[model samples]
Target: MNNKKENIRLLVSLGIAGVMVAGILFIVGRFSSSISKNAMYDPPSPLLPNSPFPEGVSLGAKILVTADKTADKEAGVQAFASNDFATAVTKFQSSLQSNRNDPESLIYLNNAKIAKSQVLKVAVIAPIGLTLNEAKELLRGVAQAQDEVNNSGGIKGLPLAIQIASVDKFDKIKELDDQFVKDSSLVAVVGFGRDEKIYNDKGLVRISPGSPTTQSRQDQTQSGQTRYVFYASPDRDNFTQAIAEYIVKKERRTNVAICLDSAQAERSQAIKKQYADFIAKAGGKVTDTECNLSAQNFRASDFITKAITDGAEALLLNPRPDKIDAAIDVARENKGRLALFGSQQMYGEKLLKFGQGDVKGIVLPVPWHQNANNNAGGNNSFGDKAIKLWGGQVSPRTAIAYDAMQVIIAGLKEGITRQSLQKALSNPNFSATGATGKIQFSPSGQRQGGVFLVKVEPCESSQSCSSSTGYNFVLVQ
Candidate 1:
């Protein structure tokens, strides 16, 4: 079968799929009016002012205080000027009771509340019951990024803290996201797009740093100043295409075994179809099977046995990290006859620790490799700093989380308001250098760093191998 060389890139473009989410953003009045009591509409809230006694609150003057019959609105402004943001928030809320549309009160209320908080709060909703390394790496990347931001004075001078919502099933996403939306201080969130609740909740901006989906919530980005969702790759389609390219262009595996975790079967079914489509187009045969699942006993060995019976020349394993062992054991038993392959889910330290040295060359497709840029150790490079800061190599999952934080930080720099952050993230021109390299978003909220097919290798290897990410990235079109 003669495959078109350009089809590889085309598969990526056509299958650059993501599920867009929709949301709502609530904003107050328009910008400032000419020659009014205030020149700027939204001013800064003091970071816990030690002393009070300022006449007015202004950015240019940094002081503007006025009064009326119910000076709650005016008292709030005075407290805001004095850096007593806690008092300012009290008065602003009292002011809102009298007139909810009070632009001045609404603006300072949000500001005073944010200023009074101990840290800038954000949420990360990740599924639990996955492997420890999977959860650990994701959390570590986020924590490291938070440390970097807080060390540098944080966003709007507030330190950062991530509230992790760990769920067991994909269906658990919405329930937790709804909980985060209730907290007004929680401006943005990062997690799985498969969390369907994120699709329903229109109050907080959500982002899936790694999970991929078939639909997108791009409409949420258009919402003026409320909630929205954004994508950051590992979309099932991209991974399938990447693997397909590798099978057709590199290994020439004619009949490949495609297996899945019964627990993850429903979630992974669509991806299996995508794999089938891509490989068939490339003229490679796909032999598919579903895993054996029990409430207490689910083994990939049974799945592998089925693949061998079907006469598969290669194996593609898609499972949560915990189930990867079963597949590796089977692939190793068959040894030279059956090749092993996987998706981004397989890119972690656990693969090395658990692969039993049997998966030395199992191939996987990932979005970022430490050596993707071919830099030894640039001070600003994402991978190098992570290794230096954390004292371990950075995985693509960690890099993606780091990049997600970088994206939010970039959006924070654009402006502190929720609406500003959404627009900044969705801005077609806005691109940032993250630990994963240059990151830009598509119109549908997909990150620009495309997928790369990486071959699994030992955690420690020779100079001939690039083991930084515990694997070597094979060049493919």
Candidate 2:
């Protein structure tokens, strides 16, 4: 009888302890709820069904409910706010007990998943026959920007990865084209504006970092259109028109002459016709056209002699800066008494240095640079980050490269599949500090911004030339 009584007493004590423990747990749970509410700035009211998830779905809830909670919720929130997606993802995952249906957990989890898959792979294929040092530098800038973004906590915590494949300029055309076709992961292509047939693939989209010929080609579906290509730079038509207008409007000259070196006269003729129209719209005239650019003794004097003989008051040419030396020789031979105008091809520092007397009055349309203005439009935070991580040299292609990586990262965060990257690139809605300007695209694969007109100035006697206003280019307002 004494043993039975002792067993009963033990059972009674155990029941009382259990009740007391339950009471204490209930009070602690309420206290935790209050702290969570205060921390999140929660109001004492229920949310509407259409509103954002309740406070219960916040990181605080996950932290308080977890057995090994350790103030991870606040850290996760901070990470997310700073675009440090990777860190936020780690913290959120740590605070979750069962993240399956938790809205906040799911949001972070989805971002992490997309980021993991968004290891964007790109391949650059320049025209095999052209010597494109500028294009190479631009593409390199883009690659370096990707590296920087990847290192800085990545997009939504996914790392950025890029690969480049360059073809020798002397390689066979067929072999070069074959190489581009074989690589399947190539999300987009750059520096192939000269060859429409190379990038005419449905699965891939091409981004032209340089100016393609303005002359229309049969490969494209329509005039001034790139069927399978997205020109990060302005289309040849817009660029040429802008150049022609600058000569007439800014330089105060008329009677323009066109010097054509392209193979087919079709594109040149089209450009001439369009340029004449734009000039007329802007109130100007075209005096003549020169079909041959490789005439014997094509000296500055020869062209000027022809221009003076033809009553050419203003010359609109397309010779690159490297070729300006020969043109300058021709001009000096002719006594340097002629007004000249050229395309963006003649706006480099070399042209300003070597052809100062020959190209004094020359006008050309070029991309505007912010650095010319106390570095206002410089690659601010994104650009600085890219330069610091990559190297000391930040080229013009830096902005687009960073923007491209951001696009890839964003798509990955939003669960954009590989199949849709091409489409997304066709018309990405996000705004980013572009290398050129506010970088955005249109549905037809053209950059949706205007070009700028720049003037070349005489620097010194055969030294590297600088801009008159240090690239202080303004819109045609």
Candidate 3:
């Protein structure tokens, strides 16, 4: 009887302890100054049934300060709030040196290190004379990310800055590169077509050693400086491969018609080669067509008519944003029978503004989408904040560019130096969460997350798209 009584007493004590622990965690969740999150944030599945390939990466907001701040933690937080990441780092370090196991101290110390680092200043370059919406959208993402980070204690405490410039002449790439190189603050350039114009036969690259190939450029330097500028968009080879694979294996569309944007002939041609190579290897037929970007009212009826005659089941457009509408118009001109595919370059608001009821079943490989499946969207706190800040529709450019900036910010937290930044980028093993998905890079500096396919069609209301934003971007496999 005594032994039974002791067992009952032990059980009661254990149950009480469990309740206390839960209560502590609940309070922490509610009151932590900065809710700390791991590197990647993935929305709970089922809740995100709309996402096709839902296992991409996303950024999670985490706690940087604790409610029960120790003396050291309090001092560090004060310093952090004042933008003195250096002093905060010092205090955090002292606190850690005193108590090796203090969690808040360790966390604050990390925050201090990141905040004390150099500010990341990425250069945004576009064709001279205008603020290309894509570039502006990208900058907006960067700006939004910067504001969020700085407001939330920044990357340990350092904020991000951006510089916008124009490339008036392709031939003047060397001159432009030289001017950029003189500014040590400039770490990466987001635009600039990766064509020979920037690296002609004369080896016009100003960073020295020009380049060998996209595969080897990020690792090599000329005169101890970076030879390659990181690109924000998807790689040409990988992009074509993803689109081709989707059509061949998933969509099962065998006969494809290729349309090229004449204004972007060089880039389009490169992508076309990848498409042709993939299609041929897959034992599929591909027909080629050309479109012009300058045409105000583009109707590629000739191209569509010829493609249909050739038994092409799908039309793949390698065109600028202006041409996407034209491509859609021509497809509609054919009564919307053929499946349409495009690359990331095919982003525009007009698809919704005009092509709503007519443009359906159009598939494209984009790096980012306002996936309702993501925890950040679907009227979630992050998604609501994004809509309120940027207004209108959220373009893919904005999402990817914002994530790219986040990637650089994450890299700065590790160790702030050009070499550190480069290694973090060039290291294939390195990965982090962006607004879209998990982002990593290959040794060649190409981003490593798998491509996601979004299609336009009839859809119901969700956090990202509704009648207000026109059609929805359904994530198809």
**Top TM-score: which candidate number?**
1
Order of candidate numbers by TM-score, starting with the best: 1, 3, 2
- RMSD values for the candidates in order, in angstroms, are 19.8, 21.2, 22.0
Q: What RMSD does model 2 have?
A: 21.2
Off by over 4 Å in 3: 1-120, 126-131, 155-157, 166-176, 193-228, 232-234, 263-267, 288-299, 376-385, 391-393, 459-469
Model 1: ten consecutive residues of lowest lDDT = 19-28
Displacement of residue 297 (Cα, Å) in model 1 is 7.8
**Model 2 pairs whose backbones collide:** 299-330, 300-330, 300-331, 301-330, 301-331
Candidate 3, 188: how far from true, in Å?
4.2
**Model 2: what TM-score?**
0.60
For each candidate, the alpha-carbon lDDT, in order, equals: 0.62, 0.50, 0.55
Residue by residue across 1-477, what tens digits does model 1's lDDT show?
246767886776666542111111111222222212122212233334333212221211121112112567767767867777788879888976885423234434554655655655566654444455565567566767776776688777766555555555555665665555554545678777554444334435676776445434324344343335666664556677878878776788878877666565555666677788899988887875555432256445565677778878788877666666765665566565578888677777667665645776778888877767647345667777766655556678877887787888888778775667777877779887777667787666666656776765544454554344354445333
Indicate which candidate wins on lDDT.
1
- Model 2: per-residue Cα lDDT over 45-78, one tens digit each: 1211122322222211222123222455557656
What does candidate 3's lDDT look like per residue over 405-477, in tens digits? 6667776677555445555665667776766667665444455555678888765655445435467667774
Residue 149, model 3: lDDT of 72
